[model samples]
Target: MKKWLTIALFIFSSSVLFAQKSVKMHPVIDTAKAKWGKIKIVNGTAMTSSNDIVENINLSKDYSLLVTAIEDAGLTQTFKSKGPITFFAPTNQAFSKLPAGEMDTLLKPSHKYDLNYLITYHAIAGKLTVKDIQRKINANKGEATFRTIAGVILTAKIDVNRNIILIDENGGESVISNFDIQQSNGIMHIVSSVLVPKTKVL
Candidate 1:
């Protein structure tokens, strides 16, 4: 009788410990839900999978360059932090558009400012959805100026057909191909081409 009681007590304690560990090990899903809500615009196709934003991006090959650049810039912690940042994430092709050998140079540890500025320039503070962008354009009479975190003002416009367009200082323009990629801390908008700052327009 004594042996049976001891075994039952041990099993109960073990079960409780396992249950606590399981709860603690659950994946973070709040961020995923926030992303879904933030990116309902530009279509939430990406959010249709698991409700884990980081997990979703990790599973995506299309965002490889963006991921790599973020890692190179040491911005993983910043992006993962408690933010509602709006990221204008460039695709692999966008990075490829960089001048020959420039990408490698920028990725070097010595060129931290260039890489940091380039990445931060693509980000805007706060959580801006596609509708918010459209509304801003309409409020500004079809055009608005957005100041990036890097202190550069970018021109935003909507055409007569309601397509969103961004014009850099160098008279170059790129359309926001994918809008409203929601994340826990912020949102992401995918652009087709890379955005080179006016200072780096050469």
Candidate 2:
């Protein structure tokens, strides 16, 4: 085990040196460094699935309502595109918790843009595993803020039970039920409630 760990450490060091040397040649890596500082080595399972975000969602029975919402909002293609998105997926039970008629109304073609905004509010630009979030929370003195794809902020904090809780812009709270479900494009964490943006809070 000691030998294996030493070998892993050597490989990690080599990779970091290579990344530093090639930063100038890779504009995307340079931009990432500029925004997020040094590369963070998050310990987790590798995401080697050939399935994209949409396909992964389709495989899950829990995401049926989310699938419908994606289809209704015409975001199927968008979610399938190449991305390292972090999606906070709410299950069918979460959608059922919404006020009656709200889902139906949002599904209407006239409310397509509104539905799109609501769904996209649950997504972040890059993959952030539970460990990454916990690290950010610890660094930020118990709370970490992340901007969603809809340009709204979501705050993450550790609850009394030590579960990661996401607080929407409108102060709605959703506990992460399951996390670090890896996909080809990114990762997904299942939430216990649908997060409503400040503008669309019911």
Candidate 3:
């Protein structure tokens, strides 16, 4: 185990020392860095650009069920694509909040369309950080709408405490628990609940 750790440390150091000059940092990246600093990999399971979004999820113990569902839905390639997408990732506990058997039924092969829809609904085009989301809220006079990759429209607003709240098509709201998990492909914000589309939430 010590030897493995040593090798991983060396590889991590090498990547930082020779990062690609061509890769441009998103404006949000610099902002995130100011707040979160350079992410330090602990046991090869950190949310650094050293790994993409999927890789981070795979490394996370909290997202095991989500990873499996993404694979089963056949939407892995889309998440792996060269993108700067904004993803609202739900934790395992969030999924667990669903009605009994709901998630399992969606993961079945017969429900690929439903599974894909749910997964895609969690993502939006481009890299939208917390600031961007708030800006959209201002532009819309306190509530802004975003079209998910699944073609479902969701609304964003801020509560009294200034917490960004996302309202799904069915009027269900989910809170962003952790914001700005940066990956090579894009950024993800951890949400406390799954935002179901109008069709599913109803």
TM-scores, each model vs. reference: 0.71, 0.74, 0.77
Worst 10 residues of 3 by lDDT: 36-45
Candidate 1 on 1-202: residue-level lDDT in tens? 9999999999999999999998788756766654444324332334442233344455567767777777788877777767667878777777887789998888899986788777878878888888999888889887888898778988889866767888877766778887766676677777877776766542
Please report the candidate that would top TM-score against the real structure. Answer: 3
Rank order (by TM-score, best first) = 3, 2, 1
**Local accuracy by lDDT, each model:** 0.74, 0.84, 0.85
Give the alpha carbon lDDT tens digit for every residue of 46-103 in model 2.
Answer: 2225667787667657678899999999889778878899999898899988899999
- Which regions of candidate 3 fall more than 4 Å away from where they truly are? 1-37, 40-45, 200-202
Which TM-score value belongs to model 3? 0.77
RMSD, every candidate, angstroms? 9.5, 12.8, 12.5
Query: Model 3, 1-202: lDDT tens per residue?
Result: 9999999999998898667533554456787777754574533456766467787898878888889889999988888888978999998999999899999899889999898998899999899999999998998899999999999898999999999999998888899878877777888888989989866553
Q: How accurate is candidate 1 locally (lDDT)?
A: 0.74
